[model samples]
Target: MMAFANFLFIVFLLPSLEALSNVNPSEYQQELNTQALILQACSNVENLSSCLSNFQGELQKSGPPTAQSIIHAALRATLDEASRAIDTITKFNSLSISYREQVAIEDCKELLDFSVSELAWSLMEMNRIRAGIKNVHYEGNLKAWLSAALSNPDTCLEGFEGTDRHLENFISGSIKQVTQLIGNVLGLYTQLHSLPFKPTRHDHNATTTKSSSDKFPEWMTEGDQGLLKGSSLGMHVDAIVALDGSGHYRTITEAINEAPSYSTRRYIIYVKTGVYRENIDMKRKKSYIMLVGDGIGKTVVTGNRNFMQGWTTFRTATVAVSGKGFIARDMTFRNTAGPLNHQAVALRVDSDQSAFYRCSMEGYQDTLYAHSLRQFYRECEIHGTIDYIFGNGAAVFQECKIYTRVPLPLQKVTITAQGRKSPHQSTGFSIQNSYIFASQPTYLGRPWKQYSRTVFMNTYMSALVQPRGWLEWYGNFALGTLWYGEYRNRGPGALLSGRVKWPGYHIIKDARTAKFFTVAQFIDGMSWLPSTGIKFTVGLGN
Candidate 1:
């Protein structure tokens, strides 16, 4: 009994032994390591010493702390902060303010309410882990929940942008505090998972899937694959939009309107070489529709509707698709609205089992909204300024080129903003064997939602990628909970050493773990992608 008591003393009360003159050497060393790791993680915070002191006390109560315990406690702490924020924001909303301020306050209140739920999600996830479920998706779900929780507060503050309110200073301070705490959570997670900032000894190797003759379905004939791979002019076309009155229809919409509704067979629309300045809406009933264009430069679909024109951020999409099994090849979808006209979306796809091959989506902000469901982009070019490629979708950009346009002075750029609001969503952005070129300093992604998940595998990142690599959405604190990772990437911007010290970003050290984000894992691309004959490199692009 005495020996057991002594063991408990060493494990739980060792931190208090530092003042004792004759502490056990082994126990003291153990305490030192625990404190050192905690302090090291908090170093990125401006109030480092205070953060350390606060965590140290919490650590003492946690017993013999493991990585999981630390994370659990951190989540609880964040929940406390979130609760305080909800209370503060709620009180502010009750106070008298201008009609515009009230609107902003209402938006913030809704965001904060959602944030509280997200934080609760983290706690629920933590509870599941503590219950010893240890499922494969356990950690993934936890990360997602934490990420979403962190993003909620930041988004709440974003609602007040450009508004003149006396509560701005106070609100900002409160949000930053929550942000810093969440950052600490992420930093801690990073430390436990990937040995933070230090390169592991594991070799970065690219893994590929096996190729076989029977890989594709029986319906996908070689002739169909050949037509999709090359130019489709003069081929048997169900309808054509020549823009020169020579084809079946003058506009793409007219061609679509004429096609047999709810047809099981592929309705191919051959768009001739010309810039079509029109908004295209592919309704849900339009399934198995294929848009074959005359090449990216020759065939262009452009629009300029923006929030400044009183368009909702979502409705601003130039070409919005809610169809299933939709395909577009060798086309350019452009939103001509410049950066100043924020929230302009060029292409918004909510289609399931959609494929965009050798295409281009161009704009300044929110260019390609991979809205939802399963989507694939191969050998395509995506150009935008901030969060140009964002949405809550299981989309994979394979062998595509992501171009970041120059932003106005004092403006930062982000390439992807994946919005995976829930852990069970199984949605994210996977850019494999792609190349990212930026004219201005840019980040690989910012969390549009808390559980935002994104991975860059075997991609080439240019010098334009900022040293930080990933940015917090205007001080959003999701580093601990988001799923951001880089695997065996090459080129100047592939340096992980200079990347942000956030906990959510991972430097994948092995093929098994890296494979989790592959085209096969993320979107089950192996099943349908081969049928298109459009090539996709799977596994870890080491």
Candidate 2:
């Protein structure tokens, strides 16, 4: 009996102990590889030790780090950092602070909430990718989420400006640590994509064909088609709004506020030709709201909100759309907030899967804010000075007109500021088959973030474009990570030799690569854009 008991202990308990003590070879190798990758990527980041320490416990618990596992680890660290910010800000909010400081603290809390949500979303996307459920929109969605995660903190810090320097510094330090962790995660995600091995296709059911408008999906109903072409005003929709009190509502907001929340159907609001001097905010609950007006200049929505008024830049949009599936056509949204005021946004679109057709967004500074998600601008005119067309959304401007407002003295002009904060994000400004005309010396874009991306393809540029096609953001060495590219752009401003010799700048030779920036592929416009019935050239040549 004693011998048998000893045998059992040796075979069962001893082996179990051994298993716990020793790492499996495969697991060991995976961990080593992951560490190597992290070290390789974070070599330049001075906070490497702190970054690793933040994620170490999570990474160890995760076991055998695959690309997804590393990404998960990074996200966990970022989320933890965001939580600290939340706690810090919450404590700050409870203090005896000045009115401006209180406001800034409140803003910080909201932004920290956003950061947490975005980090959570980044984790979710990684899980989805791991589970073989590939979303065509996943890349852009993930990037926009992480970028928002990073940008919100910066914005929060900006709010604290002139409020309290010590508080601002404290908040900045906390947020900056989190931002670095996120940035490292972004770099890791990008590394996964750049790996030589082809990623195993887990989503066998997903269609992998190149975007061709010929394969329109079931969502493109005939009624939808009619609305796209300006033929149908969607009269069957909930209401008609007119400035002259000819319809159910006189103001656009009145109609929007009364509409069914999250209604799947199009809530059409037809605005007759007249200048309406009001700020219109299509709230999130008012999904699928469609606004149409008598062609551009005739039917206008205008405002005069500027940064000089102490309003947050995000709050200064003339026509702000946070609703999903929002559509605007044949109208002009203008911020008469001149160049002197700085950072005045004409139209700020935070809507997901939103679209603008034949619309004009006119302002002197910070004109159009493509704030987030997938957005498409077709046959539209965007006029601005400075970083006029800005934000972190995966946006496509097809066959549109990009106009540059005259700049104030010593105020250099840039057309787009693609604020992609993460390398993993597919968000960028893809100006395809568009026309760029400016009165003053202009640049195609400036890097607004570390990994800013802007591409111009088959577009026409006037001679007013500066010889140095793209400029840096002050002295920022963003050229190394910024993705500024041009392809088949014609006219005097299309001089490739005179363009910046930045490491991230590209002169595209492959049509296929250029095609990636097209409306069909870039924004996944082919799937749902056709439903709007707006005629769009979905390809480079079209």
Task: Give per-residue CA lDDT, model 1, range 1-542, as digits (tens).
Answer: 44543343355435566564477888768666665566544444555545555666666666666666676666666667667876786677756365545655655565455445655666676567557654444444444444444555555565455456476565776777776677667556655643221222222234765332335444444555556647443465678898889899888888777877777767778899999989988776677788988899889999998867656455678898766678898899999899898888999886667899899999998899886667888889999998889977778888899998977678789999998765545678888888998778889999987788999988999997888899898575676789998888989989888888788888988778777777666666655567655566666644
Each model's TM-score, in the order given?
Answer: 0.63, 0.80
On the 0 to 100 scale, the lDDT of residue 76 in model 1 is 69
User: Which residue pairs in model 2 clash with each other?
Assistant: 228-532, 228-533, 228-534
Model 2 regions lying over 4 Å from their true place: 1-24, 31-84, 90-107, 120-140, 161-166, 192-224, 262-266, 283-286, 526-533
Top candidate on lDDT is 2
- Score candidate 2 by TM-score against the native: 0.80
Worst-scoring 10-residue span by lDDT in model 2:
203-212
Please provide, for model 2 over 405-437, each residue's C-alpha lDDT reduced to its tens digit, 9 standing for 90 to 100.
788999889898888877667688999888998
Which candidate achieves the best TM-score against the true structure? 2
Q: Ten residues in a row with the worst lDDT in model 1?
A: 195-204
Q: Cα lDDT of all candidates, in order?
A: 0.72, 0.75
* Backbone clashes in model 2: 3
